[model samples]
Target: MKSRLNVVFTCFLLLPSMVFAEAQSRPRAVDDFFANREILATVYFTVGSAQLNRAGEQVLDKLVPEIEQLDPDVHLVRIEGVHPRKDHDRMTELAMLRAKTILEYLHHRLTVPVDLTLTGSSPSPEVRRAGRSQHRADIVVYDNLFDPHTADTNEALSR
Candidate 1:
């Protein structure tokens, strides 16, 4: 009877540590908090002209309202331009122009200030062979919901 009582006491003492070990092994709530959500929109331009075609205007018209409806968690917007030819200087200039035009359009529509990244032309043959698809700009939005420092503090408080 004394040995059985000792076993029970030992298990009672170890139970909390076992529970804590299990909790430590599991993923933190903060790890699942922030998610990367993206919305992609492409605007195609003429071969050599930086002018926005009718289709491009239509794309922006549809895209602006959708972007405006995005959650506050969205923090970044990346605009990448892909050109047909491999002339670095010309492609870079055109890419900047395309990104700037789209930025101006979005700036007027969105209330939140977004972090923007502009990437120059992609030198891939696949993009070039896609015909009209080559002269295009791609806009991507990223959602970042949680701040790590804040999450850490909250976790400590919960403990």
Candidate 2:
């Protein structure tokens, strides 16, 4: 009788976790998060500047609306900066700064909080050429429409 009672008590305690695990394993929300990945905005900068130009500002302005619509808790944002220069280090630094500038502007303009990350890359040619593509940052937003029925059980279980 005592053993049976203990088993019953254990099951009662484990029920919630078991249910949570099942929900997390369903993967519909995860699928949507992955499926909705694309670059939403691309902001360009001038040579030797980490600041936003008029065109960059205009582009970011349009991006604000898209950012506002995302669920803060469910989405992921990545700003990838690409700057090309003769000096690799200089280009990488500029790229990273440009990305940060974009991130700050978006955060300032929107109430939606996001999981944002910054990445920088530099493609430098030994001799300078007309490569305007070097000074640009791509802002990617993942439209993670979460499944309300399923919680983030994987994280809970790991904890």
Candidate 3:
């Protein structure tokens, strides 16, 4: 009886920690959770400038409605800015600036927070040879339409 009581007490003591560990291990953001299901859109930019030209604006105009229809709830929009330049630091800065510009344009339409990623130029020789295509920003819209049901099923399966 004493041994059984000790075992029960030990389990009680560890229960909270186990729960916490599980929670910590779980995907924290909506983006991370629904990363697999996403819509990608690209906005091209001029070299060495973060300004959104006519083409970029046109891309965003079409992209905004698609994103709105995907999920009404708060979703994650990942904006990755890519530069053609070889300078990592400068490219990163330019990429970030471009991402921010895109984010600002989408902010009014999107209720959810936007995550930015400054991905420098492609290291691939083929892409490097491809020219101006690398000077673009890729927007990944992560939708969460079926997240609740999926989460419930996942939780049930985990247990």
Candidate 4:
């Protein structure tokens, strides 16, 4: 009886995780967030400048509707800025500043609380680039569109 009870309890504990995993793996509500229903896009900038040019600004403008539709409880927006192969520290700072600028634009212009994060590469050119792809940024955005809760949980467990 004791062994049987343990097995039943274990199954019960695992069931919710399995169900939630399945639900998270499926595509989510994006149409409510964007006019075109695409929840994500990347904006590129010149190698040394964090400034958004006319085209970058246009893309950001296009995302206003999606930012407005984000569900605070269910979704999170992460912004990352990258620098090409160069001074990592300076580039990281610039990227973070750029991310903040974008967040402010989203908040004031689009009425969305855009969460921003900055990342920098600490690796050598060999590790960082695929030379064929001319595009490179020292910073980038890490998206957490699905399973953020589980990710947080896993992070905690690792610690």
Candidate with the greatest lDDT versus the true structure: 2
* lDDT tens readout by residue for model 2, 15-121: 43354457657456554554687888888788778888888888988888887776656676778777765346566667778888998887888766666777675
lDDT score, candidate 1: 0.61
- For candidate 3, the per-residue lDDT at 15 reads 43
Backbone clashes for every candidate come to 0, 0, 0, 10
TM-score leader:
2
Ranking by lDDT: 2, 3, 1, 4
What TM-score does structure 1 among the candidates reach? 0.57
Candidates 2 and 4 compared by TM-score, better number: 2
What are the RMSDs of all candidates, in order?
A: 20.3, 16.0, 14.7, 15.1
lDDT of 1 by residue, 89-139 (tens): 576567657766777776776666655666545545554565547777888
Q: Tens-digit lDDT track for model 4 on 36-118?
A: 22226566666666666777677788877876676644555655444444344565455555655666555676664555433
Residue range 1-159, candidate 3, lDDT tens digits: 978954654454344335445764654453345445464788888888999998888888888766665543445456767666544656756766787798888876565544433233332456677654777888875544344554567753543
lDDT winner between 1 and 3, please give it: 3
**Which candidate order results from sorting by TM-score in descending order?**
2, 1, 3, 4
lDDT of 4: 0.50
Which residue pairs show collisions in model 3? none
Candidate 3 segments whose C-alpha is farther than 4 A from its true place: 1-39, 72-75, 85-87, 109-132, 143-149, 152-159
What's the true lDDT of residue 31 in model 2?
A: 48
lDDT (Cα atoms) of all candidates against the true structure: 0.61, 0.69, 0.62, 0.50
